[model samples]
Target: MTEENFLLSRVKRFVGSLAHCRLLGVTVVSAEPNSLCLELPYSEAIVGNPDTGVIHGGAITTLMDTACGSVVICALEDFELCPTLDLRVDYMRPARPGEPVQARAHLFRQTQSILFARCEAVQGERTVAHCSATFMRIGKDASPKAYRDYITSGTAMENS
Candidate 1:
């Protein structure tokens, strides 16, 4: 398989196993060297304003954060732990209810310890939000054993 496909598969598995994120239904639609696209399913629990039928800003932020981190992980070709140092988001429009939002993120640049990325949330042709983020890459062995175990187990299942 191609490298991009390999990384995408790995990310899919990792995200699927994250119980706290409720990421079981999310899917990685595309992945390249610098960019990744994700689909977030709509749920009433994630709604910010019930009257407006809009998803919360925190939910959108989580999408952007994960997308950026996935870009870095794909680029590095390793499951290194990277934490968001900063994230700035601009809401262009409200996301609609019952629509699965698409999040696209691109890694703009990276240094030894930092990676910069930009992302956008879109529904069809309309832009809902835009974000820029910085991530601090930790050491290869810096991740906790629980995380390592989860990822490794998921990776094995994905490869099969």
Candidate 2:
């Protein structure tokens, strides 16, 4: 497979292996060497204010965090465990009811053991929220084997 296709496959596997990602209905929209975009389809289960029909802030936060975390796999040459060191989400507004949210994350900088990323959660042309985050790099040896196995090699779990 080409590099783009290869990384995209790995990212899809990595995201799929996470239970929370599945819970949020997150899916990979696009992936590149330095960036990836994920989509969170709106569901009533995510609405915090049922009367107002606004999606929960927590759901948006998870979407942003997942977007930031998933980009680490694309940034590193070899897959590693990069746990979020810090993430700050500034909510500009609640997402509209019944509208899907998309978060695009970019890996802007990294050192030997840390990676920096930023993301925006948007619904259509309007921005719902934005965030800056940092992640600590734990090499493959220290990372979870399940995640590593899922993202690399040939046996990714279809329903994981």
Candidate 3:
């Protein structure tokens, strides 16, 4: 695989195995170096305000954070388990009912052990939420064999 394909494969596998992400109905919209886009489809189960029919803010936050982490993975030279160190989401407006929210994350900076990313969630042309996050980039030496195997196997399963 080319470098781009390799990066995407890793991301795909990592995401596929995330039960929470899957439960939230997150879908990979696009992926590339230093960036990733994901979408969360609207569901009644995720509604925070029944009267207004707005999706829960926590759900939107999850989408932004997940996209941010995925972007960090794509930015790295190799795959390693990275966890969120800090994440802050600013809600500009409530997500519209019956519409999917898309989050776009961009890697702004990286150091030896930390990555910084920014993300925005949108519905239509309106910005519903924005976020900034920091992640701890654990080295490959610390990665467990089972997690590595899961990612590899997940990717293979996706292809098949």
* Model 2 lDDT per residue over 1-160, tens place: 4887888998888888789889878999998998999999999989999899998999888989999998988888788878889999999888889899999999999999889999999988999999999999777889656657677764745554
List all candidate RMSDs to the true structure: 3.4, 2.4, 3.2
Q: Let me know the TM-score candidate 2 reaches against the reference structure.
A: 0.92
Ranking by lDDT: 2, 3, 1
Q: What digit string (tens of lDDT, one per residue) describes model 1 on residues 1-160?
A: 4777777776776666656456425678888788899888888878999898888978887787778877786677567878889999999988988898888999999888999999999999999999999999887689765565556445233333
Clashes of each: 0, 0, 0
What 10-residue stretch in candidate 1 is worst by lDDT?
Answer: 151-160
Which residue pairs show backbone clashes in model 2? none
In candidate 3, what are the lDDT values of residues 1-160, reduced to their tens digit? 3766766777777777789998887888778889888899999989999999988899998899889988977787666778899999999988889999999999999999889999999987899999999999778768766676556444234332
User: Which pairs of residues collide in model 3?
Assistant: none
- Give the CA lDDT, 0 to 100, for residue 62 in model 2: 92
User: What are the Cα lDDT values of the candidates?
Assistant: 0.79, 0.88, 0.84
Ranking by TM-score: 2, 3, 1
Off by over 4 Å in 3: 1-3, 149-160
